[model samples]
Target: MLAVLVSLLPLVRVLPGCHCQSTNATAAITATTVTSVVSGSLTSKVGGYAVFDCPVPLEYVTRRSRPLVIRWTKNGHTVFTLSGGSLTTDERYEGRTSIVEPPEFSDAIATSINVSSLRESDTGDYECFATHKNRDLQLTASSQRPPLPSSQPLSHQSSTASTLSAVGTDIVDAGVRIKLDVQGGDIMSIPPINQTRLEHESVHFSCVKEDLESTVQWYKDGVPLDDLPILNGRFNVSLEGSLDIYDAGLNDNGFYLCRIMSAKGTFSAGAFLNVQYKAKIVYSPAEVFLAFGKPGTLDCHFHSNPPLTKIRWEKDGFLFDTYNVPGVYHKLNGSLYFNRVGKEHSGKYTCTPFNDLGTEGPSTPMDLIVQHPPKLIVVPKVLYFRKLGDNITMPCEAENVDNKSPAIVWQKADGKSLFDPRVTVAGGNLTLTGVKSEDRGVYRCVASNIAATISAETELIVEESLFHQKNFGLHINSTKKNIVAYWKRPYSFCTVWSRDTSLKLSNWNATATSSDGKAILWNLNASKEYEIMVSCREEISGESLFSKSILIHPKVAESDQLSLQELNKSTGPVTDSFDIRVERSGGNYNVSWTFTDNSRKDQADVERYQVKWYDAFDGKELGTASTEANKRHIGR
Candidate 1:
């Protein structure tokens, strides 16, 4: 267990992102070979088998038939296999496991084993202990990744080796590849998942008939459970289709079937069982690419039969903490978390899991890559000023690319391309050589990369410079259901800019115009954010330019009526409360007051209300505190 924790430290750094709620891409199928302890686990469904292939060649340790004496152990070296001479086996794994028979070599027999009739308790690290030339040798068969053969030769080995308990041997690191052959089941009567329990714990499996009065039968590994001598007749031998082993032992683990004969038909459904000591890591993501700047959880899922006692997390190698780094920490739910992701958060990550029922073993490690989104380092101004025939440029810059520069595009507010000869768009900037009245429109720069996309808006007003500041302003706001836009009579025209927020490109930047003074732009697209700007002009053509610019934004109403501010006007202070007096007490210059708080009367002991101590000269607060009604006077 200590060896696993030491190997997993120094995995990852810092990150800033959401809790991995949203995803912009599908998982790219990663074809990785089985190499490390993390990727060498052999996974097989319940009641199946898994194979472990050692990296040592058949010729490495072959000395006829009795070349090397070998044993297999799990969870800190509790012997699962004691194959010294007469093929001895642990009680928990009896009759279901065996040394591979082939190659006609003695060392080949000890190098590999087939773990068959698997139950949930079999989910853990498995290591081999052997006696070669009187020198103790150890090789581990463990991984958490999908089984794939290693590209390296048989002599290939990983430099990193994990330490097992009761060390008295020379450890040899080897990769193990595991393949799981899964078979589906019917949904008629869902059977319980495979069970793993300690000695004397209860075990149950039942498959009832469509007709309660029908006959039923129970079988364990094709044999009647009642004949199990290890149970010592502690099990119920009735033919009622319910099998219970409350006082279970290691020999009781095997395939259990509850067969029922009903009017519909005769069918069988059941679960498997195995004896285990404590808990073990069952599942977790081998890799995760969380969005940068968004909060995310590094998943490290695990399971235990007797209920887990605790879990410890380690990242990029030291114990994970929020001390030096503020937002990163370990969670009790078997996952590391971050309030946000930063660039320094790129690296490998791992989890050290173990089960401490009567023994302990280290867990597999995982590596995940987090992708970061691009950022707009420089954005265009919200409004731009220009004169006739004068050149104009809107510089838009972006940074934080995912290994490459972000793609930049320039377009009008109405989703039309600005590819005219007068308009030159290079990268994120737009340059207009000769400004005209027609160019007086809203434009934006869009920058995007694999991680995310961002944009900024800027409006060019060439015709506005021809007109003087009229000193008049227009106010705008929205109600719950309507976009009420109105102005005085001299306002010759009003323009409404809207876009369907539901990603419908056909309705992008839809506009509405009215000429009869009061432009009540109502019944808008329910999903639109209307940018209603009203401009006035004396005449439609012949140098009678439109009034400067009256841009107003319609906001979602937070209350009865949402009053928007007119950016063109200067106003005084807006307040809804009154000031108080600070009394001069007998030349000591103390202040006191008695104020009543009629509101929130239901909440007692809450009043000394708005009393404050002010300097009276500078009109700034000097001291402040609430006075309790129980005591009226305060001593100096």
Candidate 2:
């Protein structure tokens, strides 16, 4: 019987914590033989459907005393059961799980169940039970009778035992078991691929899927955005896979991702958010004042994300261009450059910055005031000649005066202010009244305004009046036997004449006049006494001057008839005056004398003279000297 029980057993498979065993009854006869088998393990993605099969042989339930009962259990918990044609399911498996009937062409009476929307908790061992009531059957000698002999009957019995042994090795009569494995689910779609929100606006994003049991998560720029202290009140995510943002700012702009996770799989979707606003003019133009012929610049500053594409410059409410003006241009940093500013460059200027989002308003109008320095129009002469007690004037003029009228004044060449009562300035003209010799210096005319100062100089020369002198003296050369006289005249080209009182009218002599105030009388007779008169008259002014009438006597040469005592005693001529001069020459006294004759002639006969030296403080005669020349050297 044990052999028969072993032979009647069906094939059994080994699983984790699952075993199949069979035992035989001690009774000599049995009523029913049942074999149960389990199908292969089934696997499905999480949030998907899975089916478990239980194979039960039809012969085991045929002709049973009671109807069959089918039950499915997972991990020792009842999942679903069908008894007396009535189906029942566990509370957790309700509506989502169902039992399936076996097909008629299948050899086994099978019980199957489908689990929909599988989750991680549904992955475990599943058991199917098909139970039927047992009935008793008796075997006797008459039941063993057959159409064959007794020996043939034994062979038939052996064949039946072999068939039962094969069933016992492969099948199990306990129950059917099925293993289930749940995998992660997949994400279907995510709405709102990208979002763009203005400042202070709200935005929403959703991650959708078919599986209701899937878990949703949110991320920003690849980082998880959940329960972060920085985004505590700004960001939110719903259970239905929705992300909401409120009062979005520039910091909130970035790449956003929505992730869905389940037992089937993990999936995510990404989007980008961009924030935009209008540009603003951060720095406006300011007023600029520049000097003429100098360079200047004006800047127009602004702030924007896309940057400015163009900048327009305006002057005096009109567009400014380099085509019309030569020294104007634009700088790379959105500034206007004036290479050389002039009077025309003085105006109101504005700058406007433009970008793709349009331009900001024009900058504040800046006043560009150009000022010029003072320039001289009429210059003064370099030199001016004026007589004494005469009036003189120097003219000067200037242009490009500022609001304040230019101050004109005259100054001396020594940089001192001219404060004399004779100096006056009017209308840039410098005049001097009653010019004197003291005014004979360089005089400058200066013009000054708020902008600049300029000056010009002129030199003044004062000349004195001319005059003539009377009572002229004559000079006689006794050695040359000639008489020479010199006189002064008020003008050039004067006539000079001399006449002798003892001579006849035809004896009067006249010579050519001298332009430089000089005259000479030559070749006079010696040893004769006469009264002479000298006179001069200007050629142009007809003014005449005459010297006093005087008697002149000439001296004769010495002869052998005259003795030394006679020569000394004779009153041939007398000197009116004489001059004695002394000079030291290398430890020697050189004495010289010049004498004027009272008779206006030479004393040729007196060839030598005696000079006696005495001490002035005492009446002691120091020495006595004699020399034929007018000069002599006395040695110490």
C-alpha TM-scores of all predictions: 0.28, 0.24
Please write out the lDDT profile of model 1 over residues 377-477, one tens digit for every residue: 88886556577898998999888555678888887875566878998877768899998878876787888764567788777767445344342244444
lDDT by candidate, in order shown? 0.48, 0.55
Best by lDDT: 2
In terms of TM-score, how similar is model 2 to the real structure? 0.24
Model 2 lDDT per residue over 1-636, tens place: 222232221222111121122344111211122132223333433333444433445444332434666677778988787655466888765545554444445433334455443455566877666665532211111212111111111110111111111122234445555466554424533333456676678887655564778887777767788645556688777766778888876667786766687767775545566655445467664666565776777677776545677787898899988668898888877777889878888889887788776765887888877766567788787555567888988888777454545677777865666787888778888888998867766677787754456788766645341122355553222221334444545555443444455555533344324555553332244344544444454344333444554555654456522543364357443222344555556656677877655533445666786766543224256787888888878776
Clashes of each: 28, 18
Candidate 2 Cα deviation (angstroms), residue 479: 60
**lDDT at 562 for candidate 1?**
28
The global Cα lDDT (0 to 1) of model 2 is 0.55
